[model samples]
Target: MLCIGFDVGGTNARGCLMEFTDATAPPRQLAEVKERIRDTRAPSQVAAVMADIATRLVEQEGVDPAQIESAGVGIAGQLDKTGNTVVGAPNLGWTNVPFKSVLVESLAGAGFTPPVRIVNDLAANVWGEFCVGAARGHQDVLAVYVGTGVGGGVIAAGKLYGGHGGKAGEIGHSKVVPHGAPCGCGQRGCVEAYVGGRRLEERLTQDYRAGRSLGLRPYLPVELRDVDHMHMDAIIRPDVADAAAAAGELYADGLWSYVADLLAMAIANGAMVLNPGLILLGGGVLRNTKELSRRVVERIPSYILRAAADDIEIRFGELGDDAGVYGAALLARG
Candidate 1:
């Protein structure tokens, strides 16, 4: 069977063509393409870009369009209960967009017609991990991805668990403190406010501006140090995970350690409620800073209940950036 998978984010859209026969085995990648999203606010435009990428993949691989059985997209946004509409995508500046319909129309225009599935990006990542990555053998799993923002997904009793509103596993917004740091979600004390890559960058920038001395400062570019205002491009952006990793080499006991401790506490709290058998942590932050995950692993046992902590296993994801694409393809197979 041939499947197409896409992982659409705020900045880029990535698609892959895969061939698979067995549900348990990893799919074989035939072709892949990526494109920058010129404008996130227009759902049709983004969908058309993805369709173009898919078309290119098929043409690159010399595959018959009729052979494509299904396609899936893992997108960063709040999806409606049916998963056909994007209720809101803060990064994409979208609301109540019929993304699946737009994608279908775009694909049809590109001469490829197949059943399409849309899911939360984190859910796809977790599904990918559960199916063929770190959590493959675990029946109950929890996955936390710490990128520009923190997000999570859950698998319960060997099935993906979408809560009553089909938006479970929003661990980032779960409050860890009362009236503490502010989050982009308009909430105070969210876990994301403490450990998310964007939040961390903001905090670091603030510290630098206030002359509070950040370990991340020395590793930053000379131009970044002289900036008087907060600018995403001028500052050490979260997408550049290597800067955080570099700072950690000499300052393991600084702000990064504190962030790791807070993240571990959040994961431990999650474990207490979900009792998941396995926990998988990924995303740009954790992937680049090995010490961060190490600190999280070391501290989780201290926060979680003894009984629950004893049986839980934690590991980083194995698929790296490809988890979403792989998971989407496997999900389409269903």
Candidate 2:
């Protein structure tokens, strides 16, 4: 069966087409595409963007829209029990919106009326990793994805731990600083405010301007290299790493250390609560900042009880950005 999965975020919708045979067998990827939304913050606009992508994929791949058996949608927000209404998505400016219905309506013209399975973006990312990527073979896992904003997911007893209202892994909203940076979630000092790619970049620029000279001026954005918020790679990848790979290593050490500590604090608290079998790390932040990843991994063991943390294994996401798309597709198919 041919199925589609979409990992919808604040700025982009990453989708993949896959062929499914059996649950244990690896599905074949038929096609993949990333569509940027002009007005991702608007729910209607996001739906239109998804429609555009779906229509294009079906047309380009020459796949009959009617033949598409299922579709998976991973949203980066709080989802209701039905997984249809988005309770809150500050980044997407969505509240109490029936996202699946809107997207389905938009795709009506394409004749793709297959069932859409919706899950949280972070949850999909974790689930994808747990199923076929880094956290595979682990019955219990904790996944932390740090990108534009920080968020997490959990797999307990071999199932997604969505908790009440399907909002179990709202770890980004976990308070890390006291009266610190403001978050889009209307909270202060949340983990994302301190460690997420966007806010972290802002803080880094401020810190760099205040403390030291720009030793790596060429690597920074003309406006501190974070002008484009659509892609984390555009701002955080080569720019952050290239800048910090050299002299800026000394200059940026403090910022990376700060991010590492915040992540450790949040993850350690999760460890204490769940004591998951495997701790999975994902998102562009880890891909862009190797040293930061190392620092975070190094610190996790020290933060939790030795017995709990000792056997816990931390691994980077092997599937990159596409993890959630596959997860959604698989979920839809499964």
Using lDDT as the measure, which candidate wins?
1
Query: What lDDT does candidate 2 reach at residue 179?
Result: 97
| Best-fitting candidate, scored by TM-score | 1
Residues 115-175 of candidate 2: C-alpha lDDT, one tens digit per residue: 8888888888887887777888899998888887888999999999999768888788899
Q: Give stretches of model 2 more than 4 Å off.
A: 22-26, 40-45, 213-250
Over the full model, what C-alpha lDDT does candidate 1 score relative to the true structure? 0.82
RMSD of 2: 4.6
- The TM-score between candidate 2 and the true structure equals 0.86
Candidate lDDT (C-alpha), each = 0.82, 0.78
Deviation in Å, model 2, residue 219 alpha carbon: 7.1
Q: What is the C-alpha lDDT profile of model 1 across 104-168, one tens digit per residue?
A: 99999998888889999888888988887888889999899998889999999998888999899
Q: Tell me the TM-score of each prediction against the true structure.
A: 0.90, 0.86
